[model samples]
Structures are given as structure tokens and as C-alpha cells.
Target: MGREFIEIFEEWAKDYDESVAGQDPQYAAVFANYEGILNEVTARSTGTVLEFGVGTGNLSEKLLQAGLDVIGIEPSQAMLDIAKEKHPELTVLEGDFLTYPVSDTPVNTIVSTYAFHHLTDDEKAIAVKQFKEILKENGKIVFGDTMFASEIEKQAMIDSAKEKGFSALAEDLQREYYPIIDTLEDIFTTNGFDIEFKQMNHFVWIITAIKNKE
Candidate 1:
């Protein structure tokens, strides 16, 4: 799933920012919500932020404005180049999120916006453990992205779209396996992190999880 988007992003990285928000009202709203949640969660912190999938520096720029030292990880060189150009001060690393190695310095907050969903559920679980390793004690992971809550909801959403003659959309939805909210909680909990999940406008999901603070 993650790999699929990487190829597309390489070509789209140049105009990604404007297109992400400029397409339509709904898209603009979604982009706004993503920035808002990332800001809201990290507002109180003053530390290094390790942002995964730092595409075009959209959220990384936001984090910088919030007063955090930013280290961005991106797989696409083209996308990373844009990010570096936008903020040369930013330490943007070009590598896969699953395999990218964090510097020896521990991170205070880890963030990924609208990007983490590219991972399959199992890959996410592995990433969670890797995140725990690089974070300082009591560190947090704040994620805001596309997600669902269950198979029932997933199927129901697909059915509704199909019934409305949205067959093409339904087919795309069927092929994409988004992370479920309840399942995400269990994954985080099982991994020794405490989590909070919220659905915004019933389409976007915001997740905040703190590493094993105990």
C-alpha cells in the first residue's frame, strides 16, 4: 500500500501542496482538518519532531511553526527535495518509513498526517514498535489520516456507494484496506501504548498515542 503511493507521489510532488487543498471544498476541508489535528496534539510540546512521510513538507512546515525541531522522513527524493527547498533548516531524510533509522538523539514527538494510512495493518504494528524505540520516555505519536472502524462499516460504506451507482468508486474502495479505528486501538494497546481515537466529519480519523509511560 505504501509503495503504491510512492510512485505516484514522485510525479505529483511538485504541485502536491496546492492540489491537495485547492481541488474542492471537501478536499480543502480535509487538508485543514489534518493541519489542525497535528497542531492541536503537538501544541504544548517543545521538542524534536520525527515526521514520517513528510510529503512536500505540508505538515512539517506546520510543526516548524509550532516551534519544534523537525526531522522529516520521506521515501520519494523528489518530494524530499521540495521539502528541503521549502525549509532548508529541516533535517529531511530520504528513506522508507519502515526502514529509516532515526538519529541517536531521541525524538520528543512523532507525527504523520494523511500519510501513515499507506501502511497495511500489520506494517503499522511493526512501525509502532520501531517508533517506541526512537521516542523518549512519555513520548507521543499523533496521527491524522483516512480510516474506518470495522468491516461492517467498511462494507456498508462501500455498499452505499455501489447502490448509488458509484461502482468505480466502490471498486477502488474495495481494493484499499484502510485501518479500522477499533482495530487501531487494540494494536496500540497491545503494543503498550495508551491511545485516543476520534472520527472527524465521519471520514477522517485522528489518533494520539503515548508510548509506555508506565
Candidate 2:
């Protein structure tokens, strides 16, 4: 279901950095938001960090600077290759976050930025369970992406997009291509994880969930 996104991103890899300018008037604001995400992730845990959808090493590069060994799991080889080329020491496996192989070393933290919407809501549930299996007791999982606080809120965003003629995007949002923050919290909290989230803007959110085994 997500392969089409992979193809689009693969072709966009080369110009990805510049492409943001066309879509966003305040392009620098977007990168700044990601930097905020990096700060939050770094402050949350200083253990082994695994980043899913580590596209072009944008977020992973900062993780490395924060002195964490990062294993980046990316679905697009084109994006993977770019991320790898920049951080040769980084271990990047060509894989999807929902089904990436467990890390050989027990991980203490996991982070993903602007990703996860590729998975359906049901798929996200499976992914979080998989995250629990790979993380050590009390390990932290923090991710920043397009997450909504409620179904009504998500629908509102979709409706706004549709009004602007972003029909495909609206359909994607309506269909399970995006995550509802409430649904995600229920999945993790019921399974023994502590959850916290901050909405950065109307369309983006930063969620931090730590495994509470203690």
C-alpha cells in the first residue's frame, strides 16, 4: 500500500531539501520544528537510539551529534543511500519501520520524525507492539509527525485540504494514512507505556512515550 510513497520519495531524494520551499512559504520554520524535535528526543534519553524513516539523515545527524549510536531503518534505498553516504558509521538497514528486524543490541530509545503516516492506523498498533519487543525495559520511544488529537480534528484538517483542492492528500488523511494521537495513546498506555505529546502546530505533533517497567 505504501510502495507508491517510496517511489515518489525515491525520485524526490535528490531535490528533497529544496523541494520543501515550494510547499511551504516559511520553509525554515519547518526545519526549525524538526530541530525542536531533535532537542526533545535528545533530552528524553541518552541511550542507544534507533530512528525509523531516517530520510537523508536529517534527524539522525543530530542524534549522532548528541552522542548516540543510531541505527536508521529506511524503506527507500535512494534515501537510505543518501543518509548512509553522509554517515558511513551509521548502520542503516533497508527496511520499513512497521516490520524492521529487531536491533541486535537492546535499544534504549527510538525516534522517528515526519514518518509513520505511511502506515495505516491498524498497522501503527502492530508497530508500537513491535517497538516494545525491541526496546529494553523503560526504553523510550519518541516520534514527531502529523498526528491528530482526535478523529474530529483529523477530519477538520482533511476537510480544509479538500477545500484547497488537495484531494489526494485529503483522501490519504481520511483513510488511515495518518495517525490519530488518541488512538496511539490508547495502544501504548494500555500496554504499559507512559505517554506524553505536544502539538507543535495545527498539522504536526511531538509524542514521547516511555516504557514504564519500573
Candidate 3:
């Protein structure tokens, strides 16, 4: 399922943003929630910012618009191509989040949106460790992605997606990646990050973590 997920997202990269743009109001609200999360964490920009899995540069555009110096790492060439076309001035690289080229100086902030859940357990842990390694002492990481919700809540979201014609992919994801939030939190905490904030919106969980300084 993990490898298949990568293939599916890579294939969908070209039209990812457009498809999302036409999402139902509830799904659109998830993106809005992300904006609020970003605003809260990045109220005062410091140094360089790195984004993992920046598909089509949607969140990257918002970061750029906020006047932050940003670079994005995406494994899918198709996604990077679209991201480059959309934000020609920004630096977008093709690489896996766990093994991507990172600056030696460490970035002040690392952010990812709806991408981490695609990773396998080992990959997810490595990714979190890598984030800790590449973040400055006082740096932070913010992310928004789906998580396990109540059966009722989950079903409501599933039903909503079905009504809006998003069942195929949505159902696939619910089966594949929906219960990793607890593992994600553990990974971050084990690797020197404190889960600072968390919110459950529909079927998604938005989170922010600050790298703990020794």
C-alpha cells in the first residue's frame, strides 16, 4: 500500500492542485485550517524554510507570499515540474524527504502538508529524525495531514467524499494511511521535538512541533 500510494500521488501530481481546487467545501476547509496553522507558527519569520513533498507548490506559494525564503523537496518530477512552473523563482528539488539534500547550517523551520502519511513506518521515523537533524536548535516543524478519527466522524468524511465523487482515492487513503497520527507523534517526540499544538478537523489532524534544545 505504501509503494502504491507513492505511485498514485506521483501520477496525480500533474493535476493535483486543480483536483484539490475543485474539492468539496469540507475538504477545502482543511486547506484553510492549514493556513491558520502556518500563520500561528510562522508569525515572525526567521531564516530559511524547507518544505517536504511540496506537490504543485500550493503551500509553497503561500509561504512565498508571506515573504519567507523557501525551498521545496519533492520526489515526483511531475509534481516538481508543476511547482517550478507555478513558482519559477523558488527553488524546487527532486528528492525523497528522508534523503533530500539539506543545508549544513540547518533551516529555521520545516513544514509539510498532507505528505508525511504517505511514508512507511520506518520512512516516517527517518523523516522525523532527518527533520530534527536539519533544524536549528530553536527551530520548529508544522504539518497537516489525515489521522484516525472517531468511527462516526471518519464515516461522515467518507460519506461526504463519496457524495462529492472523491470516494475512490479517499477510501484508498483511509484504508492505507489513516492511523499513523499516534506513531507520528511518537516519532517526533522520540527525536527531540515537542508536539506543541494539535487539532482534529474532520478526518485530518493538524500539528506543530518545536525542536527541543539541549
Candidate 4:
């Protein structure tokens, strides 16, 4: 079930946003926080930005409207199809981060919203290493996703999901495949990212890290 989860998501892409549209304001605010983080990390507004796992162009549109050259990499063609329709001006590629062909032009800033939590521990380490390899000397990375404070908090989240009539359970199940925050920070620190900012909401965490500049 864990390994087959992405396949399930690919199937869900057709109606994913539609099913959650009315219920996603809180999640949307999370993405908004990522936008604010981007603004703080980069003074230049026109440089290239790479967004990994860009689902349905939600954040990509925001970056484009801010006057940045944006490219999106998404593994699911179903999601990319919708993103391309919504944000045709931005370049979008259908590829997974593990083996995706990074842009030849050094990326100035790399941002992902609610996407990194899908990587396994090994994949997370590889992703952090890859992010360092592709970014410019002073490039920044901003990511926003759910974070659990403790095992108790994690269990509380599960119980809350059952109480909420299974609202976000599908998303939660998807996250079970990846490493959450406690381990995520170690991956970033080990791969050359210096933590810049971290904030927590009820159940979500947003973080920004800068690739160390010598």
C-alpha cells in the first residue's frame, strides 16, 4: 500500500483540486506562506525559479504573477495537464525529482509547497543533495508541509482525521511514505542547507533554507 500510493495519487489527479476546492483555504494559506518566504529570500524578482512537484499550477501561478521566470516539474501528467492549462506561460515538465533533468541554467531559487513530505528518507537525502547541486551559489530553498511535534501529536492528527469524517486522511496517508520534519532537518543540514526560518501552524510547518555561500 505504501509503494502504490503514488499510483493512487496519479489517478486522483483528475478531480483532486475539485474535490478539495471548497475545503482547501487553510492549505492555500500554507502556500501563501511559502510565497512570503520566497519574497524574503530573494531580492531579485526576475530570476529563474524551479518548483518541484508543482501540482495544478497553484504556486507556479503566484510566482509568475510576481514576475519571476518559473519552471515546474511534476511527475503526474494529469496534474501537469491542469497546471499547463492554468499557467501556460510557465514552462512545465513531466518528471520526477529523483531523475528529472534539471535546467542547464543555474537556478536562482528553488521552492516547493507541500511536496517534499512525499520523499522517503533515502529519497529525501538524494533530493537535498540534488537541490544543492542545481542551485546557484546564493540560491535559496523554501518548502512548506505538515510537521508533527511528537509521536503523541502524530497520533492526535490521526484521531482528528477520523473525527473529521476522513477529510484529509487521503493526504495524510500519502505523507506516510516520506520523512517528516525531525528527520527532514537533518537531511537539509547534511546536504549543505543552512536553516533560515521555520514556523508552525496547527499541524503544518513552513521552512526556508539557504545554500551556504562561501
Candidate 5:
């Protein structure tokens, strides 16, 4: 589903931690309060979680530390390898937002951070539809990712990035499917979820969507 970005992750696997730590100025604002964002996602998650895009297992480690059972899914082998190396006991699989294996145990929550933008808007809707089928009633989806309030805001961000000489950031904003809040609201509610959005930083927002119906 998100394999289009596999090569980027392959190259970024080793340096992901540093990039998120604000070492990469081009992405510092994008990853601002990086650990805090992960912690917020972890705090919102519940039992038997399925984590999409578990890059380097940072959020996975936090989930485990909080005593939650987590199954991580990543499409990039290089990224998954790093995650495995970091947490030898972490349960992980090769998958993406639109494809993955599920255990017999019912998944109570699904959590992801900074990764959902890989999917286009249509794909995002499809993923949410599939998630509703897999989760138990009232199960939650907690995601911390970059999102904009509107098309105007999205364009403004791109312009700002360009003005700051952040061509890479601007290009990333254009290339990836960083969605608008209204579209996300439509997708979740149309898929039978009760959703809420909370701002985490200038570039990221925490989306909490609960499966409210069968």
C-alpha cells in the first residue's frame, strides 16, 4: 500500500532516530516534541494494539514499557530490522496500512505515529474501512501524524517551507498525502467511528477514532 516510499525508509532506517530528535533541521518542526508525540499516542492506546508503520520501534518500546501487548507492522525490511534490533522481543511483521495479519486475540486499539501520510486520501478511507471490520466495537485508532486544517493551510505550509529554503520539506509536503482534517473527519465518521482531533504540534495532530458500530 505504502511501498512506494520503501526505498526512502530503507535509506532512512538508520538515521530515523536522529531525524526525529531534531538533528535534521529540514524536519525539526515536523518532528518537534518527537518523544512527547510518541508518549501521547502510547497513553491513548489500550490492550492488544496493532501498530502500523513501527519505524525503529520507538513507539513500540513505549507501548511495551506501558505494559501493552503490541504487534508492529512495517513495509520496509530495513526499518523492521532496526526495530527488531532495538527490541529483540518486539512482535513485528512485514505489512502496511492496507495489508497485515491479525491474531486470534481481538485488537482493542490501533496506534500509529508520523506514518499515515504515506497513503493517499482514497487509500486512507479504504484503510479505515478495513480497520473497522477488524476491530472490536469501541476499539480505538490513535494516530499522531502531520495533517492540515484546510487546503489553504496545507498550501500555506508548503509556501512557508519553501520560503524558509526547506525545499526538501516543501517537496515532501507536496509528494506525500498529508491529509486535511475535514477529509479525515469524513472518512472516520462515514466508516462508523466517533472521532476527535487534538493538535500535538505545528505539523502533527493526534487523531483518536473509536469504532462505534459494527
Candidate 6:
């Protein structure tokens, strides 16, 4: 589970909006075109959506505005608190990608943004497997997060971050478990999904995976 990063998120809850707004110069490139990325994810989602890592309800707000039924799950209580305060009408529960309550309604789409990197590759595989089980026939998963084309590309980005003197950004890259596109494709295909990826920015990619009917 990604609960191990709850404390970090709790601390980040206050300045997260600023960071995503490109106010933090060090991370501006990382969050480039944040609004467009959120809108792209919202555009791909449909029906009842189970959104993991609904940090501060930014994407959730978009889903609601689109008139889709949204169920948000977050691990950090502090983050969840702010999200609830921002959108009182949204139902956000305290949970991570791998540990969340079973939804009462059939899930039509699963979504997340900039948060899935919290899970390691193995954990991501498990989460995808779980998604397959819970999703309705032909359901989908749309996630926008930091991912790389290959391991070499991932290390190159980290090295570049350090060279640019972005210590925090470099450390964040070294710390998190950002997956490679190939690994994600393998995971989704092995679990019966047709997956596609679209680069949203320098760091983020919008991954849309739809379950294949059995």
C-alpha cells in the first residue's frame, strides 16, 4: 500500500496547490500544463468512477462538474480533510491504491492523477489485478502520473534534475517508484486490458486502460 507516504502528503497538503500551479520553480516543468492533464483524465472517465489518490479533490471536482458519479479514496487524512472541505458534496474515504473499501456501486472507471507513483511496480501490478476483479465489464482505468519510456530514460531525467540543481525534484525522483511504459503495458495486457499512453507533459503520462470482456 502507499500509506507509507501519508505523512509526506499530510505535510504537502498545504503547498500542493502551489506546487502544481507552477509556483514552485524547481518543479514547474514536472507539473507543466497541470490543468490540461486533469481535464484529459476527466474527459476519459465515465459512469461511476473510483478515484484513488484524490489529493485535495482537484480532479474529483472536475469529474463532478462533468456530472459523473465519483468516489474518491485518499490515504492522508490531512489531505482528505482539505479535499472534503473543498468539495463537501464529494464522498472521499481514507484509503490508498492497494487498500480501499469495496465500492457499493459497480465501478465503471478507475482514475488517478500525479499520485500513482507512490506504488512500486509490484504493488501497481496487484492494484491493476484488483481493478480487473472489481470493474464492470468493459470498465476503464485512467491515470495521469510520472512515467518513463525506459529505465535509461528514467535515470537520465533524474540526472538532469540534479544537474539543474533541483535538489527536491531530484530527491523525489530518486525516492518514488515511477514505472516504465513497458512494465505498465505488460501488467495491463497480462491482466486482460487494452492499454494506451499519452504524454501529458515532461513527466506525466495519461494512461488509459480498458478491461477486456471475458
Query: How far out, in Å, is residue 180 in model 2?
Result: 1.6
Q: Local error of candidate 1 at 176, Å? A: 3.6
TM-score of 2: 0.86
Candidate 3 clashes between residue pairs 3 or more apart in a chain or in different chains: none
What TM-score would each prediction reach against the true structure?
A: 0.85, 0.86, 0.81, 0.81, 0.97, 0.98
* Models ranked on TM-score: 6, 5, 2, 1, 4, 3
Query: What clash count does candidate 4 reach?
Result: 0
Ranking by lDDT: 5, 6, 1, 2, 3, 4
Off by over 4 Å in 4: 1-4, 24-46, 167-171
Better of 2 and 3 by lDDT: 2
Local accuracy by lDDT, each model: 0.76, 0.76, 0.72, 0.68, 0.93, 0.92
108-189, model 5: which lDDT tens digit per residue? 9999998999999999999999988878879999999999999999999999999999998999999999999999999999
Runs with alpha carbons beyond 4 Å of true place in candidate 1: 22-34, 44-46, 159-172
Note each model's CA RMSD in angstroms.
2.7, 2.8, 3.3, 3.7, 0.9, 0.9
lDDT of 2: 0.76
Model 4 pairs in collision: none
Total backbone collisions, model 1? 0
Error of 1 at 70 (Å): 0.7
Q: Candidate 5 deviates by what RMSD?
A: 0.9
How would you encode candidate 2's per-residue C-alpha lDDT over 1-214 as one tens digit per residue? 2555887668868976664444534333334455566677667766888889888887787888878878888889899899989989898987787667664688999888777777776777788888888889889888887777777887887777777777655765765477777788898887679999887656777888888884
Tens-place lDDT per residue, model 3, 1-214, is 1444567767788656655664545356455455565455455345789988888887888889888999888887778888899999989886766667776788988887777777777877777787888888889888777765445665676777777887565675566555446667788899988885466454456678888988
Residue-level lDDT of model 4, residues 66-88, one tens digit each, is 78888888887778888888877
Model 4 accuracy (lDDT, Cα): 0.68
